[model samples]
Target chain A: MSESNTIPKSLQEAIGTESKKLSNDIEKGAIRRFAEAIEDNNPLYVDENYAKSLGYRNVIAPPTFLRSVQTDPLPDHIKSPYSAVVDGGSVWEYFSPVCAGDIITTITTFENVFDRDGRLGNMIFLIKTTRYTNQLSELVATQTTTSITYEPKKEN
Target chain B: MNQNLYFEDIKEGMEIPTIKKNPTTQQLVKYAGASGDFYQIHYDMDYAKNNGLPGVILHGALKNAFLGQVITDWIGNSGKLKMLEVQYKGMDLPGTPVYAKGIVTDIIDENNINCDLWLETDKGDKTTVGKAIIQLPKK
Candidate 1:
């Protein structure tokens, strides 16, 4: 493959593929752990009464708490030869608050692929999106991630 | 842990209060476990070095959370973050000071506020840039 046309056929075939998964009921302990890890002191994220005071059913997760919602990786059939991967970044659109006790379900879609010449050489940007909905079927949030994959640097 | 920010009190050019973070390797470990992103490069020095990284680097999700804190801490409890977008431009390593900063870009509907946000290195390099839209409560 030429340097300009580096995105492999496997990744291209994976586009538009999707997988659905469920998250553990949003737990107070998990929320608090994430909050402490980030050093956030917002009571709304850990204190149930405080969240209720703000009209939430229970302690609400932080704005970025959706990071805790883990999902299955791509199927083995769509493997890329790249050895190292890093996050390119993320975009989020939140429609409603994700509070504790909410059992969330995520529908993740393998969305797009692009190749760019980056600082580390030609890197493939793999885009995927996950939509989260609560038990009530209310769409809570949607997040898209850009994962950058490239050849690993050999040990010197 | 201060006064609540209201839509009426914000100006287009207003600078939101900055939030600083000194992410330790331990915090990175905790974040990896909490976020389930144990991708080796974030906490494994040898793995990182083998992959051309100088050392273990901070996770982009952690940077995202940091920027999220900057916005939520400024908007107070009543405000809501409607949209947040982050682009990781450079790798931020552990133990370095990162400043999460933002400035109000526009005020729409007399309630919705749009802003440009970033995670800046000590030398003023924006390792990560983002945009945010927040809705502040009426005063």
Candidate 2:
């Protein structure tokens, strides 16, 4: 059974449902791993002393490090119908740096969904917006991520 | 290193320093672990090929980070990165060299500098395209 038909309705109904995900306390080890993964050797991301010298309280996460901190389950209604999911894009606004030991909470809400006919038959694009707040109740960052889901076109 | 890139020192059309990275298969595995996105296409070559990929591919978010580093490194200590928007346009394979490059596009309201950024593979394929805004300190 094709699942694409129901995607639009489900996504439309999910437009304003905000789900609060598990809070993550930024940790030094996690920051180090993320920096190494991206091959970024910036001392501000891994060296506490270096970060302190730069006026930061502790080692900070790379600008996009928050991408790795989400451990929450997506709201069922907004989950992609197709198995093949790819990142479409993201827009991030950084209000403050993410420092180690800073507990951050994320509130995710579905922003939009649309369909377009293409070479691949049909493509469904889902946009999810998340707001991150630090333990001090300060807005740290806001990210809008788009995910594209589609069925692969089979060669004839 | 104190880049000390004050607002007055930069001009439109100036190019930001480029940062190059070589993403290995092992690095992809580490990225999978750290990002909790254990998608087989990023770590398992066989699975990737079956899925129509050339081989273990670098994560899109990882590529985004590379562009972020380019802006942060160029802005130095006093500048604050305010916004970044990226579109993942192409896939990048592991073990390949990716270069992050940007050029200042506009100087908005004296403090905000908007730059266009992108990641290009050694073969000249653009994998990611984006824009960033930074607020630099006044000298």
Q: Who wins the DockQ comparison?
A: 2
Docking class of 1: high
Output the lDDT of residue B17, model 1: 95
Question: Residue by residue across B1-139, what tens digits does model 1's lDDT show?
Answer: 6788777888889998998999999999999888888889999999999877899999888999998999999988778899999998999999899999999998886446799999999899999999999988787
Interface DockQ of each model: 0.82, 0.88
Model 1: how far is A35 from its true place, Å? 0.3
Please list the C-alpha lDDT of all candidates, in the order they appear.
0.87, 0.86
lDDT of 2 by residue, A17-109 (tens): 788677988999999998988888888988899899888879998999999877455677677666667798999999998999899998887
| Residue A150, model 2, lDDT | 84
- In model 1, what lDDT does residue B95 have? 87
Query: What TM-score fits each model?
Result: 0.91, 0.93
